[model samples]
Target: MHWFLAVERRLTRTALELAIIAMALVVALTFYQVVTRFVLGHPSAWSEVAARSAMIWMVFLGLAAAFRMGSMIAVDLLVDLSPPAMRRIVHMIVGVASLVFLAILIWYGTAMALRVRSQNLAGMSITIAWVYAALPAGSALALFGVIARMMEVWREPAGAHDDELKNVEGSV
Candidate 1:
């Protein structure tokens, strides 16, 4: 279990690093675009496409990174009020559902990417498939993160004490 957690942590860190790089690229590209449009009076032809692609990758990868950190959007107020047993049950159900949903997303996204592989982008000479590959790639990472979290929750014995939950409750 410790080994597994270590690996997951490494993966999360790597994803976060990639997300930061993508954000930097997007900002630099935007600055370049602005400079060309105003100073040179000649906007870059590929700037728009590049920015859009970077934004897509940034958003998707950032979402996965956030999910790994347990920072994704959630309505856990009710869960906070529930007993620990109930909270554990709810967490397990949610984890299973998330895994199933991600599996379906991977299947569909891969299929769509394959279908578009032979297609070309309108303005750029790049393959349309590359643009569409983000879906499955993000889904795959999210799926792994969810499974890791689920395993953590499941491996706990019933009635196990959660130190974090106790701290939150001031029950220490």
Candidate 2:
């Protein structure tokens, strides 16, 4: 159990780091685009599309990172009032349901990305599949996060120190 937890923690940490890097890249690209467009008087044709696409990826990755940290948004007024044991059950059920939903998203998103593989974006000559790819990739990461979280919930000991609340914010 300790070993498993160590692995999960490492995985979550890695996701968080990757999300931070993606966010940084997006900001840098946007800044670069603005500077080049106004200061240099030469706007990039693909910068707009690239920046927008990067934002999409950033959002999705951030969602998965949030899930890993147990920071996904939730209305827990009722749960807060419930008995501790019951609250654990509720959390377990919700986490499993989320896993199911993410599975479906992974299925549909992968199909969608593949279906548009040959198509190109209207403005940017890049393949549409590249844009759609973020959906499935993000969903897959989120699914793994959900499963990891559910396992932790299921095997968790009584009075366990759980720090899952710090990771939930605005996710995709």
**Candidate 2 at residue 18, lDDT?**
69
Q: Which lDDT tens digits does candidate 2 get at residues 1-172?
A: 5676566566656666667777787888888889889999998777777777877777776667666656644625545666776767777777877788878877888999999989987677789888788887877777767777667666766425244433323222
Best by TM-score: 1
- Which residue ranges in model 2 land beyond 4 Å of their true spot? 1-7, 75-78, 158-172
Please, what are the lDDT tens digits per residue for candidate 1 over residues 1-86?
Answer: 77876776666666667778888999999999899999999988887778778877777676566655444346255456668788
What's the distance in Å from true for residue 19, model 2? 1.8
- How close is every model to the real structure, measured as TM-score? 0.82, 0.80
Candidate 1: Cα lDDT at 107: 90
Model 2: lDDT of residue 46: 72
Model 1 stretches astray by more than 4 angstroms? 157-172
Global fold similarity of model 2 (TM-score): 0.80
